[model samples]
Target chain A: MFSWFANPHRFVKLSDWLVPACYVLAAVGILWGLWQGLWIVPKDDYQGGDIMRVMFIHVPAAWLAMASYLGMAVMSFVWFIWRHEVADIAAKAIAPLGATWTALCLATGAIWGKPTWGTWWQWDDARMMSVLFMFFLFLGYMALRAAMDTRQKAARAGAILAMVGALNVPLIKFSVDLFTSLHQDASVITAEGPKMAAVYLWPLLISSFGHTLLFAALVMTFMRAEIWTRRAAQLRARLMTGD
Target chain B: MSGAPILSAFRQALGEAWAGGAGALLPLGFFAGTTVLVPLGVGTEPATLRAIGPGILWVSLALSSLVTLERVFQADTEDGALDLWLQTGAPAAAIAAAKTFAHWLTAGLPLALLSPMLLLMFQARASGALLENMGLYAIGGIAFYFWGGVGAALSATVRRGGLLISLIALPLYVPTAIFGALAMGDGPSSASAPLFLAATTLFALAAAPFAMGAALRLAAD
Candidate 1:
């Protein structure tokens, strides 16, 4: 099964249908989630009031930010073990999207924090700092990939890096937690499981799924584009050599 | 097989790094220079300097370690010693470990030694805490070298790898920085940070060699 889709031609054909389907599902889910969250859900009494509506987008973006890295790490593993071309392409495709989501998460969190915590940034927030570290990890991965001269070299080096980054992610989170606890303040946010009501929880779940589907769609679209780009380069090289 | 080859590789690496007296002293120089500049940039108020002293020291350590990272594999690879080492049939990870051990000896250890002076200059009062933090710096510096070794190995094939190595390494340095800083902080809770810092170094010891070996092989290819 892996071999069947490992071929770029077959992968492209499959993604042609898969990409559109994912995008459509993502659009519906996201739109519905926004409606439910922004209009139907009651405002929080203790927090930012109507400003908490941003949680609809904020939570999902944050969830996808972490999820995307895990996704890349899994693809990196596949590429490292099997030398799967699609796996490399998929991992490469997911990076910028993941970085963007992470950026969005930070921005939204900042916006939410401004109204709720009276600060645009919180150094003592473990979640915020770790997410920032994750962003830097993404930047490093992208930079390393761009630095390598050959595709295979880039893929292998990037796979190793992704694995290393994956290992460090948890350590970063843990250390940040410990570091923040040493300098404790009365934080508005806690690490406890969501104390949110059903109305808020359901929308968050739906939006999170929507974001996942959206990420899948974007990765597939980018992968298909990358496959074609490689094919074109190969064809051009062949034609030039023949001449 | 005999351990002779690994030992020689280790010695060769150490000798190469120390061959030029200036190269051996570059990180220490950079560490001290950066530490000096911090006060000039951030104002010399003793309380302010003391408050941020540990963080500044760790950042300088991280930056200074990166200054030498490109040379970790670049010089060997360029001169074909790395190729010869690969042909020796020793595990690439073992070779990488030896080389990185040499790097720690030459670059990392000095930084740890120099850190105490900077800490004193920054007006950290507690002698016992300063000594403990110095010990943590030694451990953390070893971890930094190994982590930077992975970056150095990955970018060994690139002609200008200095910036790329920094980009690749500084993020990996985040945990070490956080833990090291926390360990230097006051209170009983801060004591656990050194254990975490040690754990990070141990993890780097086990993980970096393999990652570096794989990346070196890729660069060789």
Candidate 2:
């Protein structure tokens, strides 16, 4: 099956149909999640009653943001070793989306923290710094890629960085563990499973899945654009050569 | 060049710092001005200054390297001297070592010399902290430039490379900053940290030349 999808044209054809389906699923899932999280789920007694609901989207976005970078890092290794153009394009496409997800995480976290944690920001916290570090890494990666004059060179530079920046992924993940910080443990990726009640948990899962689907669909759309753009450039070059 | 790498590197560093016109001197000038500005801006409280002195020293070291890293191969690439370096019989590592040593001598050494003024400007009183921080900064500066040589090598192919050079160099710089800061910590220095710093600096020095050389070949290719 991996071999079957190895062809970019075949992958493009497959993604065309799957992309719309993913969008439909993502839209339905997100709407259902928001409705359940906001209207149906019970409020927390410790924090502001209704404010706790924001975790449905906020937590999922944070997870997906980090996940996307990890995904990009993996693709970078592939690009470096295999020299796959698709891998490079995928890595490039995920960066902005990952950055957006990171921003959403920070913004929503701040909003939630304002009522719960009693502040919008805290510096001594490892989690906050890790998030900031992720943001910087994302910006740095994007800047590095754009700084290059040619696509291949950019891809090469970006691939090396993505791999090296992989070092930061674990650092970000474990910062809360290693340091005495305000950031909480992994709610979803834990071994003992989620600690939240089923009512709150269900919406969280749906929203997280919805975001993942959305990310996949967006990446597919970007890949299609990149492939088309490259082909168009090639055609222009051919015409210039009077072929 | 056939003698010990240490002597050859030192000689080359001294010679190359003043080579190829005045552009090489720009980092030295920039380092001097920035160091002077630090003292002037921080007021004359010696104790207060000493507390923040190490941090400021490292910051200048990093920025000074940033200014000159572009020149490592930037002018050479533009003028085609880099191509000749690539084609030379000398090992790429030797050339990388020479360039790094030259970078440290011209950029890093001047920053180290100017650091006392900046520290004095902050009103640092402790001579021990000053000397220790100075030593750490000098060694860290050499380590930093070697890593930066990798960035410069990779960036030689780009037109406006300064921004990308910073992106690549800054992440690798965190450990140096951390160790350099820890080395100047309040009590007797932490045993682990200085050892770690020395090991990291040696690693960067030994490993970066090869990585940089490979990157240069890739850029050339």
Candidate 3:
């Protein structure tokens, strides 16, 4: 599977059909989720009524923010060990998406929190701070890549960074948890608890699945464009050398 | 491998740091300047200063460590010292560690020793407690220098890479800053706080050298 997907042509061919299919499915899933979340489900009074609906957007974005960071790191590892250009392209593609999802997560969480937690921001909140830090890590990876003068240096530096970050994500999370616990009782997420009804659970799960599809589709599209741009650059170089 | 490589690298780094006006002292200046700004920026209420002081100091120390990292590998890369070292057949990881250890010794250690002064500025007393907080700064120093060194090495060959190094290092500084704050906070200071802070320090100590080594090789390329 590694070598199979390692080929840029294969990726291009596969994503040609897959990308469109994903777009349709993601649109369906997301629209249905938004519709159900906003209008269908009965908001519990104890859960802060209408504001809890933001969970459909916030929870999925939160999960995908983390998932895509790991995905980028995995791609970086693949490129680091195998020197597959496609893996590098995939990783480069994923960084902005992961960052965007993280931003969405933060924004929606803040929106959700204003009423529930009584504040728009809580610096001591472990989850908020961890996700915020992860967002910076993603941006740093991109900035590091851009700083390198050569593509190879950029890939190597970015790979080392992504791996280092992936290793520390758990430790950062744990330390943030410790820091918060020792300092104060952060507005616990236990307000609604895990006793979520099936009505709320199904939409949340489906919306997460849809968001995952959308994120994957976006990554594929970016990778495809990058591959084409590289090919064009190579052709231009060849022509310039011949001339 | 023998300790020769680390010892030599550490010695050479210390020598260079000393001759270069001991750039190690530079972070202390920045650390102090930042401490001065915090009270001015936040106003000089003793309670407010005391409450926010630990966090602000840990964060400033983390930032101050970053200022010196821009030079960590840049000087070696510019002078071709990196090529000479790599050709010496030494383990790259060891060399990276030694230099970073030396960096901590110079830049990070002074900041750690001066933590008492910072605490005093925040209205802290108790000489015994002051020394303990200084030790906490010592461990926090390890995390800061090693992780920041990884960024410095990665950006070593890039011209004007100071901002890039800060971008890369700041996120990595999170655990150190967080744990150090926990260790220093008067509220519910767990015995485990220092242990967790040490764990972050040790984690960075173990991991960052290899990353710096890899990045140094890339810089040499």
Candidate 4:
């Protein structure tokens, strides 16, 4: 199914237009989400008034952080079984982007934590620790990929690492949760019976979509850039053969 | 992938690691040294030491396991033994399981044995349920070694891959660390924590070898 991703000409032709379209759509969504979240959303006095706004950014970033890792792992599995360069490339491209979003999630989460929870970080909080482990998982993937001497070896090593990480991440989360869970027990359940007020819910949903779109655009751009870089390297090698 | 005895590789790996004498004891030294440092770094209040005792020891043990992994598969790769094993139709996963179990016997088990003395250093109770603690430590040690073995195999071909191995293995060590630490908590007779710890060990025991095998295949590449 993803064999099309490995076809350089098709990938190039498709991404050439899709890339620009993604960028435009991503910009609009992110801007509206930001504008609505920052200015248009009302302050909820039940929680800390303005600090709650951090949720608009933190929540979406957190969602993307988890999603991107899963995407990387699935791509890695495809490459491991099918030996597709594009799948490998997709996995590689997702690592840094996933890491960046995880960092954002951690930072914004901490920011929200400070005024609301009165601590910048909580060691026992299962969500925070699991996310931090996720950050390290991304770093380990990139480091393992970088240490390899050849493209094939890097892809193979990275694929193995990513898959292992994907499997263990859940166990890590479960273990951490079992020992101690300091985070709120489903904020939606706090007096609201798990039904978020529609006002907050709608914008949060839109903003999350915006973040997802932005992430997709970024990943596509990265994959396209890597494909071009590989092409250039091959062309250079061909030129060298003339010597 | 056969469950039949692959003890020859196990015996071979054990003999090689045991033959290293002083080199083989490096993780033991590293484990004890790191455990002792915790009290020195933080003031030696018995209450404080006892509070942090099991958790710190687990952390040290996890870190020390990295030392055990560097040579597990790398030695075979260097000697061309890895290639031979790949070509011999001997199941890579079974070979990996044998090698890692043997490594646990030599490098990991000693650290598990040493945990009591170190826990004593922290002024924690090493007498009550002493056997239970030892059991938990040993099981957690196996889990650590198996996960560590996967990292070792993945980096078998890379030079100075010790840090990379640690980086990769540490996250995988979370379940064992949590369950092991908690097993020491809520009293010793309580079965839940140990059950969770044992379950984690068994899961790693079952799953990590295939990963190690796949990684060794890549290292062979």
Candidate 5:
């Protein structure tokens, strides 16, 4: 199935409609989520009161941050194994976006932390530290890719880094947990279920889904732009040969 | 089929490193220089130094290990030694392991041996436990080199990869440093820290060579 879209022309044709649809759905979901979260949801009695509104953005961004990397890693695996140009392009496109979401998660987390935990950054917090390292992992992938001279080499290198980082993500989380015992226990979002009321939970869920759609839309745009850029470069090379 | 090539590769790497005398000594010099600068920069207050002693030592080890990483593959690749190794039909990972062993022998081993004295210079109580400190540093230093070798291998084709190598390797080094430092400290937690530290080294030993081998192949290509 993925092999069918491995061709750039097919991918472009598919994404032309898919990207706009994703953007429209994302915009509606995000707008509705924001309205519901900001105005309709009541203030938390135990937590930061109205400031808890940031959770709608913060939680969704954090989820997408991890989700984007997982997506990149999967794309990287596809590229590494099949040598798919589209997969490589998709992986490369996801790096900066993933990094941005990771940053957004960190910034909003810090803002939320300042009020709730009484510190802007907590070194001992496993979630915060692991997320910070996740950001670094993304930076390292981008930097390694940028430093290489050839596209193939860069893609291969980036693929390997992404795979290694993906493997280490679990280890990093575990190590951080072991190295520091202090952590904010999952109160609202639990494995059993979300413990929050429907008003807050619905908005958070919608926002998380909206963020996923937005990320998909953005990735499609970047991948399309990458395809165009490569085409132009090929054309330029041909013109130079003709001259 | 035979161990001769691996042994020769290791010997050649070690001899080349030691001949410069600088590669062997550079990490030590860097370790000592950084240690000296810390007191001057942070003040000679013994209590403060004692508090941060293990952390400073690990950070110094990390930085010093990074100092020699660029040369792990740069010199070999530039001189075609890597190509010769690749042609030997020995797995690239095996060659990487041999080179990393050579690197550990020259750069990491010395830092491990000298860490006790350095710890004393900072008035760290770990000076009394020289054997334990040496053990921890040896394991931790090897882990550093193994992981750093991955970065060095990845960046082998890049021009002036020294800083880039550090940027690539340092994040990977975090677990080793954390576990190693924890092991060196005096507390209830110290018992488990060394075991975890050893686990980290084993993890690096298992993972890095394959990554390095792949990167080296790409560089050779």
Candidate 6:
């Protein structure tokens, strides 16, 4: 099944159908989650009412944002080692999407922090800076790829960069836990397991699923476009070389 | 295979980088500016001066080392010396190690040598603690430079890859930066912090070379 889908054309065909379906599901799920989170979920025992609601969006977006980058990084390794065209194409397509998710995570994090932490920004804290670092890493990766003129060379260089930069992901995850970090300790997700009650968790999971599915839909669409563009460029090069 | 080819290449091209002289100027200038000029510009109270000294030193290392990063692999690759290195069949890891060593020798060691002078310029008391903090910065700077090497190798071609190098590298430097500053903060005689810095640097030194070498091969291909 994996080999059958390895064909670029076959993958594109599959993505072409699923893309619209993903978008519809993502839209519905997001809407439903927002409605439940905003109006239905009760106020936190400690955080009062409005402040806790942001978690419905913030938590899910943050989770999916990170997951997207890991996905891209794994695909990048596959492209580098196996010379898998589809993997290469998928990674290239996912970069901007991953970057967008990172941005959303930061923005939502700030929105959440302002109400709870009494401040929107803090530098010395590892958690805040770790997220910032991930954002920079994404931008740096994209900028480096763009600067290179050749497709193969760009892809190879980008893959190496993504792999080496993987170290930052752990930094992002554990920054708060390990150091005298400024960000508050993990409220929901923890080694001991989430501290949240079921009412809050159910909506949080739904929103998280929504964001993740949205990423999947976007990545597949972008990869389809990338495959077409690459084929067109190859054809143009071939014709110019009279192949 | 014999190591003779790598040995000869190292002996010849080692000076190619040194010949540029920017490596020496970059770190040395920052060290002077931070340790000397900043103190002169600020108030003269010893307590205030000592408190800020550790931060200034780390900043100097980061800023000054950056100026030399663009020169890391670019000129060699452009002039085909890197291509020659590739042809020599030296292990990629060894080539990366040699370059990283050359960089540390020129950049890191110079900073180490300048530390006493910098401390004196800041009127930092020659307490045992002060000396230990200086040692931490010096050793930590070298180890941290290897991680920087990995970034330098990866982004060597980007138009403003120098800036990107810092972007990619700064996160990795966080633990080093935090630990280094805290080590110094604990006082010059406090051995624990500097020890941590040294230990962290050793970890970086061991791992970064092969990672950078892989990036070099990817860049070459």
All candidates: interface RMSD: 0.8, 3.3, 0.7, 0.6, 1.0, 2.3
Q: Which stretches of candidate 2 lie over 4 Å from their true place?
A: A1-6, A45-49, A167-179, B1-14, B20-29, B35-48, B88-98, B113-117, B187-191, B199-211
Instruction: Compare the candidates by TM-score and give the number of the best one.
Output: 5
Clashes of each: 0, 2, 0, 0, 0, 3
Instruction: Give the top-scoring candidate (DockQ).
Output: 4
Q: Per-residue lDDT for A44 in model 6?
A: 83
Any residue pairs clashing in model 2, and if so which? B46-B123, B49-B122
Q: How much lDDT does candidate 6 score? A: 0.74
Please give the DockQ score of every candidate, comma-separated.
0.81, 0.31, 0.82, 0.84, 0.67, 0.55
Error of 3 at B154 (Å): 1.1
Report the C-alpha lDDT of model 6 over A18-127, residue by residue, as the tens digit.
99999998998888889999999888857635877888777787776677778878888888877788887888888888888788878877887787777787665666
**Candidates 3 and 6: which is better by TM-score?**
3
Candidate 5's DockQ: 0.67
Clash number for candidate 1: 0
Query: Per-prediction TM-score, please?
Result: 0.94, 0.85, 0.94, 0.95, 0.96, 0.90
Candidate 6 TM-score over all chains jointly: 0.90
lDDT of each residue in A115-186, candidate 3, tens digit only: 876888888778888999999999999999998887888899999999999988998898777544212232
Point out the higher-scoring one by DockQ: 3 or 4: 4
Residue B17 lDDT, candidate 3, scale 0-100: 68
In the range B126-218, model 4's lDDT, one tens digit per residue, is: 576666687788999999999999999999999999999998999899888888887887754346888888988999988998999899888
| Better model by TM-score: candidate 5 vs candidate 6 | 5
Interface RMSD of 2: 3.3
- Local distance difference test values of all predictions, in order: 0.87, 0.75, 0.87, 0.86, 0.87, 0.74
lDDT score for residue A81 of model 4: 94
